[model samples]
Target: MNILRSPPVPFTDQASVSERRSNLLDASTISPAGFAWLMLGISVSMMLCGSVTFFIGFMLMPWVIGLLMVFYVAGIVSAISLLGRSIICNALAPPSPRKHIPDNCFFCSSLGFDN
Candidate 1:
């Protein structure tokens, strides 16, 4: 016996109108909390490393301690800047606009239009 296979349907045909629209809108949205957390974790790690280096430098040579201090200060500055930028971006992102279209629009009934 021979088996027959059908061609795959395109994406537009696989989902309802509402679902497709919702997916498009969701794709454009960014997770602000996730960004903030990632920056915070990286900054903390940098500070921890700087502290360890400073201790090691103090044990080896007093002059090396100054270099480590600079490293520590730079790390702190970077952390503060990243955190401030993340907060500002989260605050400034505008709310998602509503999708509107007349029933008579050419692509209103189908997901064939590209914005």
Candidate 2:
């Protein structure tokens, strides 16, 4: 007896091109400096939001407190998602061969390849 096969899911040409571009972007990894900048921005924003929430809570504004709580949770979720994406991108891209070199190595120094 032969097993029946399911039909393939169909996507538009535009969607196929978009999917390819998305894959390529997903495969690409950002530099350490870029990653640092992104993290710094997220951290600063989180801190600012936390401080605002604290101020509103201390001021005894119930509505503001509730709004701040919602905003804080959303921010945390977004930060976690961003971090997950960064990790996945880093994992998908191949590791640099020079990454294993010691800081004091002459080859790494001469080549300026300390990534």
Candidate 3:
């Protein structure tokens, strides 16, 4: 009933298969010197990145401080300006009128109080 014949698969015993896998794993394992070199490369790259970031932060510190200082001065100036305007407005505005009572007031006489 087969239209096309397929190649036969080779059978392997459990012991031989395990032995071959172990040999492959042993061959692929890294040597001590290679591990040391890998660690050295990683450390050098990390140190370079750290130094670059530190330099960038150091360079930008002055600008950041100056911006904060500008904002603080602007806030102080705005507060002082508002205070001055309030004082000037109050000084220029007319005084509130005061109530005057006549010396011979009828209300006081009716209340039996002598002026």
How much is 61 displaced in model 2, in angstroms? 7.6
Off by over 4 Å in 1: 1-60, 97-115
Per-model TM against the reference: 0.31, 0.31, 0.60
User: On a 0 to 1 TM-score scale, where does candidate 1 land against the true structure?
Assistant: 0.31
Model 2 Cα displacement at 84 (Å)?
65
**Pick by TM-score: which candidate is best?**
3
Off by over 4 Å in 3: 1-16, 95-115
Whole-model alpha-carbon lDDT for candidate 3 = 0.79
Q: Least accurate stretch of 10 residues (summed lDDT) in model 3?
A: 1-10
- Candidate whose lDDT is highest: 3
lDDT of 1 by residue, 1-115 (tens): 0012232333666678777666655555547776677678889999999999998877889667778999999999999999999999989999788997666676754676534
Per-residue C-alpha lDDT of model 2 across residues 14-96, encoded as one tens digit per residue: 55866766655554656678777878988999999999999977888887779999999999999999999999999999987
* Candidate scoring better on lDDT of 2 and 3: 3
Instruction: List residue ranges in candidate 2 displaced over 4 A.
Output: 1-27, 61-115
Candidate 1, residue 103: how far the Cα is off, in Å: 20
The CA lDDT at 25 in model 3 is: 59
